[model samples]
Target: MTVTTSPLLAVRALTVRYGAAQALRDVTFDLAPNSALAVLGPNGAGKSTLARALSGLVPPVAGSFALDGRDLTGQSPDTIRRAGLVHLPEGRGVFPTLTVMENLRMATACDRRGRAAAVDRAFEIFPVLRERQRQAAGTLSGGEQQMLSLARALMVDPRLVIADELSLGLAPRMVDVVFESLRRARAAGVAVIMIEQFASRALDFADRCLVLQRGRIAWSGDADRAGPELLRRYLGEATAA
Candidate 1:
């Protein structure tokens, strides 16, 4: 498998706050190209906050994030995105009224010359998207909409893909499809940061794991070494058996 030992992105002493309430505190980690890092934690563990801070959607009050030694701590979302970092946010961040093709075109709008080719690349990943190219995205089922969202992100050809809840509400088969796409992205040398609530699935697919509890990293290490018992210890006893 393609992998890199050097860090592609690094976060240190990261912190985020909403008004007076701190959402994340002193979070730190590193991600490498051609690898998948799973961020696992229960709700309110700051998983989503971490994702938003990385994407520049939410401002971090402390610490820093750097990509290839470039400080991205306070960059605008547009600037961060253009710098080869893409965030596939939860709830399928797609334009509901836009057609499948149109939704994809929006992602490549910054580079109109590459729109056609980008759309073609998207279709290659999810052929159903090609069939529904003319249909409104809102009309598509949950799984198809999620596929469209993933396909659109690929339009940017990002170096790092942060997927927040990639398989939230999909059926087993659809979840498999989304994960397969993620694997393809990883194999293609794209660094992936998966923020998922499904601990078992995330731990199984990721190369490394970071477990969060109360907005702090409870554990961090190789996923292969984090056996079921170890994960359950930090994630609570309710984790899958």
Candidate 2:
């Protein structure tokens, strides 16, 4: 006998517009559990828009998306998040005035009973956070801050994390550290959609690659084969850092 497994996410013809400017044009893809999909594009390619639309921050002008086989289109952001889709937007989304511990505590507001376990799990995943638990979140280095941001996101027990430009303004070493955290997340069976500027690193980390151009899917295929010329053409930037 054979058993079948379904995809963790399914998006079909996802379309979004900002006033008269179409942001996403019939974008569609499927992501399986434990998979990593790297989204690459030039500026104004509508990468961030796609993430916002999926998380319900921006309503789609047309199309549909689902999580774990459940239709999630038109759902509220909070409702979709509670159902296990988490969006980690660009920047270190931590409370600067709050201590690392306090920031993590905020993530557990919806699950008081799991607070302790969640904090422990976060520390276990990123031990550096544990060492700086009492320090102000704003006092950490860029890499450390990114770690805290990821740890806080995991507290909600999300099934998929859409990371948008996570490596934005960090040093080369810090980028390595941040990507390692993402690697660990994938190893633990959390699917990831990485919108990244470092095309080479992103392609190496993800198995599948989707290149967007002018709010449309310009190409989609195996990451290993996404040539540099193609990146230069569609990505509009050199593939190498």
Candidate 3:
């Protein structure tokens, strides 16, 4: 006998458009609880558009999405976020002008109870943020800023985190740091959808992979099956693994 668990997140026939141009057409996938999926494609493949649509930043022209059996199609971003679906966009989503401590504090604004504990937990995850808590976020190094950005997930207690371009422009060492942060989130039973241009490491980290081409799913399968050959075939030289 086999037992089957429902997917933590489900996207079915998701289509998006900008005016008459279709950005995504019938994109579909499923993610189990606490698992990770990587979205890989060349430039203009609608990777970020998929992230935006899932997080309610872009309204989909057709199809539906659900988290934990709750339909989230066409809901507002805030509504989706509060429902434990968090989108960490490409820019890290940190308030540049605010101090590191101030930014973490901002993440706790929704709930008044035990806010200090939330900040402390964030500090525990990224002690570098603690050491430079008083420093302005804009002045921090790219890696440090990304640390501050990921801390919001801890403060808000997310179930499914959509991280787009997490390792965009940083030193190689910093890329390791960013990936470790993602590991910690998955360890805490949070699902992750990583939309990455740099494919090698992300492909290794994810349990599954979804490939998009011209806004449609070109390939979808286990991450181990997504290699240089597939990348070269679909992405050309744009995202060579």
Candidate 2 segments exceeding 4 Å error? 1-4, 237-241
TM-score of each: 0.93, 0.97, 0.97
Residue pairs with backbone overlap in model 3: none
- Give one digit per residue, the lDDT tens place, for model 1 in 1-241: 9964768898999999999888889999998767889998877988999999999999999999998678999999998988888999889889999998789988988899988888888887678889999999999988788878878877898889899998888888878888888877776678889987677888788999998888899889998888888877877767533
- Residue 155, model 3: Cα distance from true site in angstroms: 1.2
Clashes of each: 0, 0, 0
Residue lDDT tens for model 2, 68-162: 98999989999999999999999999999999999999999888999999999999899989999999999999988988988888878889999
How many residue pairs of model 2 clash at the backbone?
A: 0
RMSD of 2: 1.3
Q: List the residue pairs that clash in candidate 2.
A: none
**How many backbone clashes can be found in candidate 1?**
0
- Angstrom error at residue 92, model 3: 2.7
* 2: Cα error in model 1, Å: 17
Better of 1 and 2 by lDDT: 2
Candidate closest to the true structure, highest lDDT? 2
Candidate 3 lDDT, tens digit per residue, 75-167? Answer: 999999999999999986888899998898888888869689898888887888989999999999888888889987767888999989988
Pick the winner on TM-score between candidates 1 and 2: 2
